[model samples]
Target: MATLVAGANAALTAENPGLDHVVVGMGWDTIPSNGPQAELVPFALMCDASGEAVSNDHLVFFNQLVSADASMTFVGDGDQEQIDVQLGLVPAEVTKIIFLAYVDPEFRGQGTFASVRSAHIRVATAENRELVRFNLGTDHLDSVTAMIFGELYRHRDDWKFRALGQGYSTGLAGVAKDFGIAL
Candidate 1:
């Protein structure tokens, strides 16, 4: 069973201490709408110790699935997305990896997170043993277009996961800006 984390900033270590690879999975159901089709896209932003993206290569999404070092790669599609991270391969300068769920532009133009149902993010070992999970639908907000679900950061020489549960009304652009991405 996975450990359930209740709030933001809650930290949990991966299931197997010896594991070097972990998967961050996010899933959501699209609520029926009269407008364009609803799609939830998951992405990751790799940041340095200053919480700023090291480069454009650090932003992994549908178009750019893998990071520069191949430490992180986005997997799956549609309502579900998974990110595979090779902790040992991540660069020493990279200090944090943030996972996010965004309402695709077509869908965001018509609705917000309120149109997403049963949204959740989970972290697990390479073998599929879940370590921690956070449900992003607990407090759905119509004004928000994206969610900063959680983050994996370097703690001493080890990595730790933190449930952020933060919402952004400015869409992906806002998130990109916050992480030092030019566009």
Candidate 2:
């Protein structure tokens, strides 16, 4: 599959019914800086049809590696943190699984996005055969503090992958508020 740009999306299960499971991976490279570099922590938000996170436990990251239902599991691999999703096992109330990364607030006090570049997200089969990839564009990275790399959402009985290179200049708090998370 060809690489996707910001806002572009592709059908997942619809293309291959057998593709019921996948590993979504996110990766990035940091730009050298004199000041303390920003700490980037990748996480997944399992949201309901309302677009808000179902609960605090629905937020999966390095700290909370897996969902209670055993549907989404975080797998760390070098610079990339992956989430293995069992599509068929996802809760019925969940409509989307969003992939995001934020600047760890404790690191140099609300760090800027300028510290990272060449960020990307990709989807692959459970066996690691990459299906599609999205390279986040590098425009206006200096001010942003958090970013949404991509998302996998439900469409009827199928799932779709979207490249979302959007960010929050207000820091992680902005993301928490928008998603109704208590930080």
Candidate 3:
């Protein structure tokens, strides 16, 4: 079962005019189960309207955005860090963001199973604060562990949202398959 943290809340509009699509920024560390450090894995963005994954199969990158391996690489400590991505009307019109995450089976030995202690979704704004935040519970992400859902409205639009529009949810990756929102 999955949870809908926020319905379709408009975050932008024709008047405000947000970019039609977005490329997600992602970075993570790969650590030995018992080692004290972690390494970063590279990441890529997929703009497929059908929700097809963006892997080495479709696009390639020689440097920043692209690499030889299918997944993006992050070289550093295992701790989580934020990465930047470009957003625009390309590949396809992306109104939502999807995060595909799984517990590193090896991580259990180290105590962190690639679990997202917390997660949120927001528009690109003057301040980095999120327009909305979604929480996650065990039930929301049983196998994957957690999922988050965020609605990207046309920029500068007034959307109706509950006070706690943010709640526990399985990240967008989980919901897209069923609801077709991320697509």
Candidate 4:
């Protein structure tokens, strides 16, 4: 992976001195597939500092994952209960993010299910500065546990998610706290 670098305004060329643009490439491959398009399990995003969604965190999440066909992708917002295309405000200084790929609830029993093999994050500032690039790969069960725990942090505060899985919630909450993003 490339090191995170600052963005430059495209309009601000040697002659223009105004236009700016920043481009980042996030890539991944499923284990043993060696294919270009890897299937990513639905991963959650949260604030590494506060362990909660303030405002800017939402912005960053949308900016990174939002798309027209969002409903069909890993973070698909295709279902109304999930999300559609919508913009929200981002917060001031975001430090870190986490990712996880897992077997969907319906496909959990099947061995052949999509998992988040790898994740990459890139932040482009107003002038298109690439401020952050982070990647994670799941190679063992411990990593999988941590990823699930991260998701627990994301949904812990919600009343609707309260009854999803009592045992898993408790365990995941503890894991999230341990990772510095408690709920």
- lDDT against the true structure, each candidate: 0.79, 0.87, 0.32, 0.30
Q: Please provide, for model 4 over 1-183, each residue's C-alpha lDDT reduced to its tens digit, 9 standing for 90 to 100.
A: 133222211211232233232222233444554432223344344344655433322322223464232211233222111222111211223232233333332322322223434444332333435434444434442223223311211122110011111112223344344444324
TM per candidate: 0.89, 0.95, 0.42, 0.33
3 or 4, greater by TM-score: 3
- C-alpha positional error of residue 90 in candidate 1 after TM-score superposition, expressed in Å: 0.6
By lDDT rank, best first, the candidates go 2, 1, 3, 4
Give a tens-digit lDDT track for model 1, residues 1-183.
Answer: 444554544344433557688888888887787775447678898899898999998878888989888999876543288898999999998999999877788743646787677878888777777877888655658778889888989887778887778899998889988889877
- Each prediction's total of clashing residue pairs, residues at least 3 apart in sequence or on different chains, is 0, 0, 25, 19
* lDDT (Cα, tens digit) per residue for candidate 3, span 119-138: 43333222333333334332
True lDDT of residue 57, candidate 4: 26
Candidate 3 local lDDT, residue 48 = 44
Worst 10 residues of 4 by lDDT: 158-167
TM-score of 1: 0.89
Q: Candidate 4, residue 148: CA error in Å?
A: 9.0
Which of the numbered candidates is closest to the native, going by highest lDDT? Answer: 2
lDDT of 2 by residue, 7-102 (tens): 899998999778889999899988776676778989888899889998988888877888888899987583378889999999999999999998
